[model samples]
Structure formats: C-alpha cells, structure tokens
Target: MNTATGEIHELWEIREEDDPRRSYAFGGRHGQFSFARIMAMLAKDSGITGDDFRVFFYCGIMTYEEGGATAKEAAEFLGLTPQATRRITKKLAEHKMLLVAEIIGRTIKYRASPHIISALSGRQQSEQAAAFHLPTLPGRSGSATKGRTNDTSRPVPRTHRPAGTDERTAAPETEHTDDVRDPGRPGARRRTHRG
Candidate 1:
C-alpha cells in the first residue's frame, strides 16, 4: 500500500486471537482499526456521542512514533501549520491525553500519556497501562541497601557483590583496618591503600 497520505486505499480484515478488526495500510505504513474507534463504537452503544473521535484518532496516531516526529513534523503530517499544531497539542495536554516535555531552545517535544497509549489498543484495559509506565532513569532504578556503611547519596541502584565482600574490599588491611581486618585474614588484603 502507498504510505503516502491521500485517501483510504484498502481495507483489511485481520483476526487477532478470536476477535477481528479492520486495518488500513498507507505509505507502506499500516494502521488497523484503532482502539479509539472501538471506544467510539462502544460509546455510541452507551449513548455518548458528543466526543471527537477524529481528533482522538489523530491524537492516538500522533502518539505513535515514526522516525520520531516533533510537533512541527506532526503539524506537517496533519497538513497543519506549526502554530495550529501547537494549539492542538495544548488541547491534548489539557485533556491529560498527552504530555509536553522539554523545550530545547525553541523546539518542543511531546509524548502521549500511558492511558492514551493503551486506549489506542483495545488492550488498554489489560497490558497497556503498566507497559506504558515510564521507566526509571539511570541511577534511579531501585532502592538503596540499608546499613551497608557506604555512601548512598548517589541515585544509582544497588548492585550485587560477591558474598562477604564489602564495597571497600580493595583497601589494605594494615592501612586503616576495620576491626575485622587482619592482613592474614581469610580473604587477605588484595591491594595497599594509599590514603
């Protein structure tokens, strides 16, 4: 299928598990029946029809990464000018559907919140919520070990060391030996400590 945007080129009927959904392929890129569409269908069944499905669909599509589109890039993708894109992005943010992060110089980068990410997939109820949770940054992955007698000011998480070895195991026992230190001790000192 031509990934280039224009008209709905082809409709596909695909099966997932026991359920089936329609799909559309464009510009060599493929997007099937969106979770947003399913939600819209359900909403129609329940009696809520005032919502903007088209905007939600585009927002979900925007959440997806394609060579990582910036707001300007997204604007171009939607045939919108940069300023118009900014307004739409703000609206999405106000709805808690998108997250606006970082402005380097004049460029703004945004990402969708986990809820929106999951909502795009009918699986939003099952896996998307947890999967979309942002991963911890480096050095903040886990909690510090307690009573270890080492400076834990660093955000880096604790790592495993061989049994019975303290973090300062490299120091010479004779230099500033711990009471447990005996140069001749079972794990004899491996190196001399200058300070």
Candidate 2:
C-alpha cells in the first residue's frame, strides 16, 4: 500500500485475440440471426403469430451441426401442445422461413434458414428458434386454468349515492298528463306520474 500517494491501480486487464465486433452476436458464438428480416416477417399480415415465433426460435437454437428438431420436439421443449406446435412449424415452413432439414419416417425436421439464423455448429443453416420456459400468458395458446379469481380488492362501483340526491333528484323525472275528459274507469288512467 502506498500510504503517501494513496492511489488504487487495476489488478489485471483482459486481452482479446479477435475483435468483439467481428463476432456476429453473443460474442461470435452460435445462435445469431438477421434482426431486420425477422422483424419484417413479424409485421402485420405476415400470417405468423407470436406462437409461431416461439416455436421457430426453439427449433433454430436447438439446431445441431448435422440435425434439427421436429414439431414434437419443439412442443415438448416449449411446453406447448403438439398440435399447436405442428401448426406453427408448418406455417413457418410454408412461408419458407424454415427449411425441411430432413424427414425421418413420418416426422419432418426443420432447420433455420441461413438468412434467419446460423446453426450453432450444424452443417445446415435454418429457420431459427430458442429454448427456456416462457410464462403461460394469455395469447394464441389459451390459459390452461380458468384464471377466474374473485378479486374483492378491485375498485367497487359507487354504490353509495351522494347526500341530498335520490332517484328523482339525481335524474329529472318527466310528468305525464292524464285525460280526465275521457269517461273511463276511475282508476283507468292512461298516464301517471311516478313518485
């Protein structure tokens, strides 16, 4: 310690062999994508829903050097119904955003389009997707539970009428005239005023 000067110096500094900018994304690691194109596809009338985006991301991230995942795989990994997952995957594939990497028996695997995302180490490029559990928000995939809860804390309507105001005072009452000239029954009044 320098008691007189009293100054702190860096313990150590990091050195890099390659430029950080040189890396596509995530420090030049895998799972990179073209943001511009993806945003365009997600615009209105794109026919792609948020669910489709979710599945697409999952398949893309899971794309291995030589293989990709099927709709079933995506559904399992994303906690979505297989049918819903299939719908999303098919829609993306039809739009040419995803490529049919291969077909095993009746199962069709998908890869991210090279333009959309580069495989982590996969020989093939493809439509991209990601992993990690997402909250079951209210959207394409409806909530599993009824989600109906009685919230008594909510702001209650103004049940208490203001002082000096009743139905008649609050809202002006319209008076109806009776035809006394007509020789009808004593109580047979056509119109009457409400209290």
Task: Identify the candidate with maximal TM-score.
Answer: 2
Candidate 2 Cα deviation (angstroms), residue 71: 0.5
> Model 1 segments beyond 4 Å from truth?
1-59, 118-195
lDDT of 1 by residue, 113-152 (tens): 5553432455653465465433211112241123221222
Model 1 gets an lDDT of 0.48
Estimate, for each residue in 44-151, the C-alpha lDDT of model 2 and write its tens digit: 755567788888778877664446789999898889999998877766664556678899898999976666777444443321233311222222233222232122
| lDDT of each candidate versus the true structure | 0.48, 0.63
| Model 2 global lDDT (CA atoms, 0 to 1) | 0.63
Each prediction's TM-score versus the true structure? 0.34, 0.46
